[model samples]
Target chain A: MRAIFPAYLLALIIALAPTSVLATDDVEGAYRLGGGYALGDTGLRLGGYASTEIDVPRTAPWHFSLSDLSLFLTWDNGSRLHFFSELEAGDLLSAGEDESLGVQNVHFEFERCYLDTLVNNNLTVRVGKFLSPIGQWNIIHAAPLVWTTSRPVATENLFSTHATGLMLHGSVNVAQHLLEYSVYGDASETFEAHRSNNPFENAFGAHVRYYLTDSLQLGATYANFVLNDLQPIRYNLAGLDLAWSYQRYELSSEIVYRTTHHTTVENTWQGFIQGVAPISQQWFVIGRYEYFGQTQADAGQIGLLGLAYRPLPPVILKLEYRLGEHNEVLAPDGLSASFAILF
Target chain B: MRLRLVYPMLLILCLAGFPAWAAEPLAVVTAPDYPLSSLSLDDLKLIYLRKSQMDAEGKRWIPLNLPATDPLRRDFSRALFSLLPEEQEEYWNIQYFNGISPPKVMASEEAILRFVASTNGAIGYVRKQKVDPRVKVLLLITPFPPN
Candidate 1:
């Protein structure tokens, strides 16, 4: 199954290529810069993004790699039903600083596949696999949309990044303010598990976000899950996050803590605060600080400063330097650069 | 002498108001039979931003947009969101990644009028003077004063 997935994806892309070309002639002005190509009047659209990164570590071998190549398909019935899916192939090729280059064994996985049914103006029911709505970063983590090349540790480690099952999500307006909520659960294993993923067996969680003002939002999340580890430990997790923007400057932060029911020594927690300030219309300066700790491992802290340039909305170039103490594998101390484009 | 002075003053006043009079007012239009007769400014904002998909009646609202470079589009965006279409690029980028696309873009106001008139639940904006009986006008927007 794992080996055939890529072949299937290749065939799908090949089949869609001619349709996309025909769509350009059938639909007037069907293509936009970042937006996908509409498949005639059928309501289906095809789009994707790609990114490459150069990693230079202080004590490790430097390398350059094709980090992510992702494709997505979306269909809207123009009424009550909508469908979306994303397939990603990561680390397709790599070259070491020692003048060696080769095609790396790639990991192909379905990042998101779901159907959304509109129940009303204030509610939507979604079934299948979707990004866990725990915080803002996880859902919009695409390379072209984010400010930095590296993700915060807390956002990736504290909970299941993807949930396979069902979710009920909605938003309502109250006195000119917006309130959004989601409740989701997954009882079975992931549909197509990737070796790098930390899949979970059973989990349920809820998230709520309130827009205090047009530029400020606060969110809270809670979840309980059994990690698919060798011993299958059960854990409870909680988190809080904030996002605020004034003009072109922005600030965001999230903190997550997890506790195991079987052992006190295995509890873990992490937090981070990131800020982006616009230097000009297309240039930005970013700074972030993070701290991660586990009961059984050395606690670590890291700080990063980066600059990003967006020549266009869907194209970005980033360079950053990282410094840290008691660093873990995820938070390496180094300099990294990346270029990404969404089409 | 008094008559001459009054004539000059009147001429200056007319000249000062010429731009405002020549500026075309925009109208939010939809199918003649679209359920709602009017939409609040807040609702319009939400709909265009893709924050609100369905209306109070549980029917979807398909919003249409003019090309970003169109003068009418610039005026409409400024009047509706207080931002130019170019300024909202970042917002649209994030929305695109989340599988929520911005309103479909039409080539011209004529295309918008034709689409909105024939399609149910369709909504678009066009010049008030160009509005015909084929579409129903929901809201009228006057261009903001230039800075």
Candidate 2:
């Protein structure tokens, strides 16, 4: 714990040293600084501007509090390396499930750490832990960076926010169209479970993306991941996504159909349509509608609405509300507000 | 008819003298066979921008630009990218910062000629008279006559 402070500070200095003095500083001028804060952790749950539950009616408790601080540094070339590590100090004093999730564990994890290098010319290779480049949206997964607080159910079914491994990503120009492609080989030591935010055993996946246009993208991914020593379920995900972004307004949708080797389990599918419209240059309104069918026994739909304020190019502050429903134990519905920063 | 012969002959002689007054414009050098066929303005934009690679016949089109400061480079950008000199700088700067390197640029017209002559799909432009058996011209960039 003591080591992290000095190391982080040193990194900050090294990264911030004005490179303009150097002649090759074409990329030295582009760097961003950002972080987030929340006020409550009790029933007043909110992450950033995650969602508004009342408008849509979700019965679950909101997860909000003072948590998740980050700093992002980028460069002039689209190639970027972002180190997003969150320190949840709120739970430090909390005991456990008994007192409150204690911060004593001081759980430290890297949201992203990668070096994006464009090889020779066209090919780009990303090494280290980074967002899985499975789809257009997953690569830029951040609460503050996004218009909506809650991502669609499709994202949940398709891939995770971060993946650790080497990603080969680049674009090729065909006859008249541009074909953007990415092939990733992930080798993360551990994986997070989907439900309950539980820690699962080690997991890994292979992902790919093909862009039909500047805005529209088609993707397919496969994960031969294991969970809790259960027979490794061969998870297969095929998805179609259409996204268009302009200066002020943007819309993106992802529809994924998931199938596994287990025949007893029902094939599942989910989708989401997310839209953001700028009210002004600095402020915007965002909304997302998500639906998923877990199995014959359970399925639900969710809606999210939020407002975002960007004071600068790379810094974003958002306030959001989300409403979603499920079939059983935890409650028929849930909502959460979250604040996330992107580098 | 007999009386008008002298006036008609003088008019013909006057018309014949005009060619001496206006020198013929410099001709462009391009590939003779393929002739850069089927590429629209947008297609050319895509090719030059490195979004499109293969030429119409599937030969990897090595679209070469002159070095940044070269006159030929400016001429190509002005004609194709449709950008003024300042705009071209900004346009390439954004792309450069976006992690995209510009197309390969040769040092001089002779360097382009040598390289294009050696490589099968290589492409470059030069004066019409500079053309020879060593290379093939694919297209032309004629200058607009001054008003």
Best-fitting candidate, measured by TM-score?
1
The residue ranges of model 2 lying beyond 4 angstroms of the native Cα positions read A1-21, A24-62, A71-106, A115-118, A157-160, A189-231, A295-297, A327-343, B1-147
lDDT per residue for candidate 1 within A107-138, as digits (tens), equals 78888777788899889998767888888888
Index of the highest-lDDT prediction: 1
Best DockQ goes to which candidate? 1
Clashes of each: 0, 25
lDDT of 2: 0.50
lDDT of 2 by residue, A109-216 (tens): 545444555453346677555555555567555444455554565675534555656677666655555566666765554322212122222345555555565445
Tell me the deviation in Å of residue A62 in model 1. 1.2
Model 1 compared with the native: what TM-score? 0.89
Ten-residue region with minimum lDDT total, candidate 1 chain A: A18-27
